[model samples]
Target: MNEIIRLEHVSMAFRMDLNRTTSLKEWMVTLLKGQHRHKDFFALNDVSFSVQRGDVVGLIGHNGSGKSTVLKIISGIYKPTQGKVTVDGHIAPMLELGSGFDYELSGDKNIFLNGAILGFNEKFLQEKHDEIVAFSELDDFINMPLKTYSSGMLMRLAFSIATIIEPEILIVDEILSVGDAHFQKKSRERMRQLMEGGTTVLFVSHDITEIRKMCSSVLWLDHGKIQMYGDAVAVCDAYQAAMI
Candidate 1:
């Protein structure tokens, strides 16, 4: 099997300063007074995992269980403070809603910008532009500024653009809950299509049913560490039972 993603002994630490000086003046005063102090918080601890090509993996955990941190590391948005992350393919990450979006720009223009951010050339984006708009069902509002869009509309556009080009790896973090039921169904169908094309997907969702239905494997993270990882049904069942 080909390994598409690997995290070996990954650990992430964030420093929380005791005194948060908002202004430069306050910061300078604190520096001069030598009162700055910070405590470290590890979001992930010695995490190790490897994803093979064509695997659909789900990440399940509590709100502060570091699921988002894992996804960010995989997306190359943040470097691991310790250990290593190896990604063998291009990643299309649909993280928090409204990320990488310019509210002041028209939806059409933002599409190009987002495409560029995803490493797509203008020629390629132009070629896939119609398909993206068609899938998003935002033909009438495509030229309008994104600031006027609702959360659902914004997600629709983002999802469409992210899925337009098939990526080797797709990273989704709590994004399946954004749109209406119909749109969510459409998006799932698109994801299934991508899977048919051999895309490896790493997904994070609170919905255990969705995870079981869509994922082949599950990694349950708790307290910044992997609690269990294996078959989706077994891991999710264990996690769900533990919660009850």
Candidate 2:
């Protein structure tokens, strides 16, 4: 199998300001007084993993266990404080709903803009424009300003544009929860199609059922560490046992 992503001892840390100090002056004052005002929060702790092309992997964790952090790092939105991350293919990350969209622009305009942000050039987007619109089912409102769109409409547009053009690696964080059930089903079908066509998928979700349905492998995280990494059903069953 072709390796699509590799991470070696990846770690991320954030500095938390306990005293609400947002300015350099305040930070310096606290620092000069022989006091540390910021505490280190390790979102990911020496995590290492590898994914191959055509693999559908699920990430499961409790709140604040660094599931989202790993996705962000893999998507190139965040850099790890330690270790190396290597991505060998084009990546499309749906980490946040409408994250790359311009709310002030028309939905039609934002589609092209967001597509470009996802690494698609104008020619690629042009070829898939009609399909994207049809998949979103937002033909009537496509020309309207995106700020006027309902949350569901926004999510549908974002999801459609993100998934319509297949990327070699796709990272999805729980953003699919925004759309209605019908749209969610459609999106899942699209994802399955992508998987069938050899796209690697990294899915992070709180819903075990969804993960079990979509992933062949699962990584269970707890307290910013890996609790288990193995077959989807086996890891999921262990997670359920631990929770119970």
Which candidate number has the best TM-score?
Answer: 2
Candidate 1 collision pairs: none
The segments of candidate 2 whose C-alpha lies over 4 angstroms from its true place after superposition are: none
Clashing residue pairs in candidate 2 (N, C-alpha, C atoms within 3 angstroms): none
Candidate 1: list runs displaced more than 4 Å: none
Model 1: how far residue 198 lies from native, Å: 1.2
All candidates' lDDT scores? 0.90, 0.88
Q: Could you tell me how far off, in angstroms, the CA of residue 125 lies in candidate 1 after the best superposition?
A: 0.6
What is candidate 1's TM-score against the reference?
0.93
TM-score of 2: 0.93
Per-residue alpha-carbon lDDT of candidate 2 for residues 1-244, written as tens digits (9 for 90 to 100) = 7788999999898988678677899878888986756788999899988887888999998999988888899888899999899999888878875788888899899989999888889998999999999999998899999989999999999999999877888888876665889988898788889988888989888899988998999989887788899899999999999889
